[model samples]
Target: MANPPAVTVCLAGNVGRYKSSLPVGQLLLRGIMAGAYIAVGAALCTVAGTGVAPLLGAGFAKFIGGAVFPVGLIAIVLTGMELFTGDAMLGPLSVLQGKIGWGKVLNNWLWVYIGNLIGSLAYAYIMVWGPFTQGALGAAEPNAFGLNAVAIAVGKTLAYKSVGSIGLWSCFLAAIGCNFLVNVAIMLGITAKEFIGKFFGIWFPIMAFVATGFEHCVANMYFLPTGLWITQLFPSLVDKSTKAADGTVTYWSPLLHKFGGLTWGDVWLWNIIPATLGNIVGGMIFVGFVYYFAFRNEFPEDLMK
Candidate 1:
């Protein structure tokens, strides 16, 4: 059965307290696992969605990608690993409930975010060398999935960079929408008592966020780097060309030329930074604070203990 609202909120606070109290090493280790798990889903999405846009419509392609992207969160929730976006809500909720202080909350965020980065980078490296490339890293061409990864990275960064400050705002807003759904998924996961219930509870909202093309900081941790590494390793792929029947060569990667190849600067400035900030607001304020205040008075005394 599902938990009542008050019970769920209290349970969330309890989970938050346990998370915040973990030592730095535990936080980092769990964070690394969570990051890699998220990358697993992202890799699956990239491979699954590749070339589907032409065969199916763009919408169906998106749905296919989104449909597979929840494996990471499902794994994380069931296994008790830490995710930064989820922590953005859970840690603050613990603070609101007087279960932990803001200092511990921020501490949890800091270590977990760093660990997530490390894990994502590790997975991205694995992808570039493993499935994304045709053979050895230096000599091999990027596979179809790798090429798609490049396109996705470009869309996330250059598409935003093209618009200046407004681009940052757009990324930020999209991130808000992303984590709002993410935490909603987290809440649903908490409310469910059965494994199958937890699975579907987390799946739908996560699928919604990805299909809608919202920004997610941790998932982007995987996506941006995978794209950036592929582009950097295969620089020729940046401005691809095709020979027509009449011997005319056309450049397909217009944005790549306009913005240059994906840079580390572009990754941070355009997507992760703003997305992280927006995720904070979306989770900490939008879901955590809203739900906490709504049920703070209703939490039973035993539940608080």
Candidate 2:
């Protein structure tokens, strides 16, 4: 049997209430695991989608990547690991139920986000030195997987920066869309009473977010940094010369011009920073508050216990 909506909302709060009480160390450790799990999915998405576009067409290739990307979140949820994106909604919802304080919510967010970053970076290094690089341990050109990483990074950062402020807004909006669906996916997982039900519930929304081209900060923590690290190791991968309108040669992208080559500032400003804010709004306001009000008066009596 399926759980009722109110019961699901209450269960989410119960999770939030329980998680809020965990010590910093436990939260961080779970967060680390969650980040790595998410990166596992991100890496698979990048590798699987590598040459698929040429054979299956662009839209289908993206669909393939998106389809595989949900496995990370599935593993995280089933294993009971903490994800910052899900926490963004869960923490606030816990507070709304008067089950936890805002301070605890903030604390949870801070530690989980940091833990996720560390885990993502660690996995990024693994991919950079392992699957992304050549067989002789960085001796040869980056394989197709590495090339896809570079392409994903460039498109997220440089492509957005080229459009100016509008690009930032686009990133921000995309992030909002991402976390909104992410939390909905989380709620669906909670709504399910059976393992198989939870699995499918989580899979579809996550697949939709990635397939639809939404921005997710935690996943980006892996995706962007991995791309940056790989490019640093193989600068030639990004080098390219393009013809200018004046017929003069311009070095950019593959040529290494424009934004002066993917700085930390560009990474955060173009993608991460705005994406984080948008995620907060998406999860906190859209899912947290919306659900809180939806079931506020109808909360189960067991919740009072």
Candidate 3:
């Protein structure tokens, strides 16, 4: 998640030496699993993005990501894995609260890491290689008029400043701030003595996050660019010449490119990357240190082990 507080905490916790550490591979793997959790959430957002308007008024067409996406994220955070966004908080919180040992955090981090990579990669492949890949791909491309609309959709919402104007530090800060609220919601779920009340408590903030455009760093790993970036989503009828990175061949996906006209790469560069970084910054920094400093007085003994 590299959310808002991540960098600050990295600096802050490093002072007390309370931060968790692991091999580089494990750290990367944890990020991947966290990314997978995010990808699932993003996929839900993508569905909301495309189907909401047309399906409006239909109960089934309700925007799913703004509420349902966080439900799954809870499972990822609690069940185990190195969810980067939440991990930025949860792992540290566990240590500070005396709920779990740092070693256990590392274990959770490992599996989740691998799961995230598999998840993000698999989800991306499905969106790119599967039936809807072409249609999704076509939506993100620069139009025949040569404008990248998908990029605009994502960047506008994420940057909160300008298209192609937001800097790296800004994305980092904003993303972390957004996720800080997310972590608070999750903490409620984890701390509540009752499951029903927990669900009730957790639902509100998550919904708020989605409705208000508070970014979840992990979800960005999937939704922002993949929804608009890859060209394969445009289908083959219009452009048979485009090929994969290997440059071995070009093939039509499913939809006809002349119909919708989007691509993956266009979305990836303009929308996905920017938004991804934005989510990370928003969640990690903005949210991270706010809680850490606020609750520093409550630091427990068990986490010190």
Per-residue lDDT over 1-305 for candidate 1, one digit per residue giving the tens place of the 0 to 100 score: 99999999999999999999999999999999999999999999999999999999999999999999999999999999999999999999998898989999999999999999999889988998889996656764577899899889999999999989999999999999999999999999999999999999999999999999999999999999999988888888766778899999776677887776789999999999999999999999999999999999899889787
Off by over 4 Å in 1: 136-140, 243-249
Q: How much does candidate 2 score in TM-score? A: 0.94
Kindly give the stretch of ten consecutive residues in candidate 3 with the minimal lDDT sum: 144-153
What lDDT would each prediction earn against the true structure?
0.93, 0.88, 0.50
Candidate ranking under TM-score, highest first, comes to 1, 2, 3
* lDDT digits (tens) for residues 184-275 of candidate 3: 66556554546665676567777667655545545654554453444334433334446678886553322223234444444444344554
Alpha-carbon error at 255 in model 1, in Å?
A: 0.9
RMSD of each: 1.5, 2.4, 10.2
lDDT per residue as tens, model 2, 30-149? 999999999999999999899998888999999999999999999999999989999999989999988989999899999999888888888888998888885544454577788789
Whose lDDT is greatest here? 1
Q: What RMSD value applies to candidate 3?
A: 10.2
Residue 115 error, candidate 1, Å: 0.9
| Error in Å for residue 191 of model 3 | 1.8
lDDT of 3: 0.50
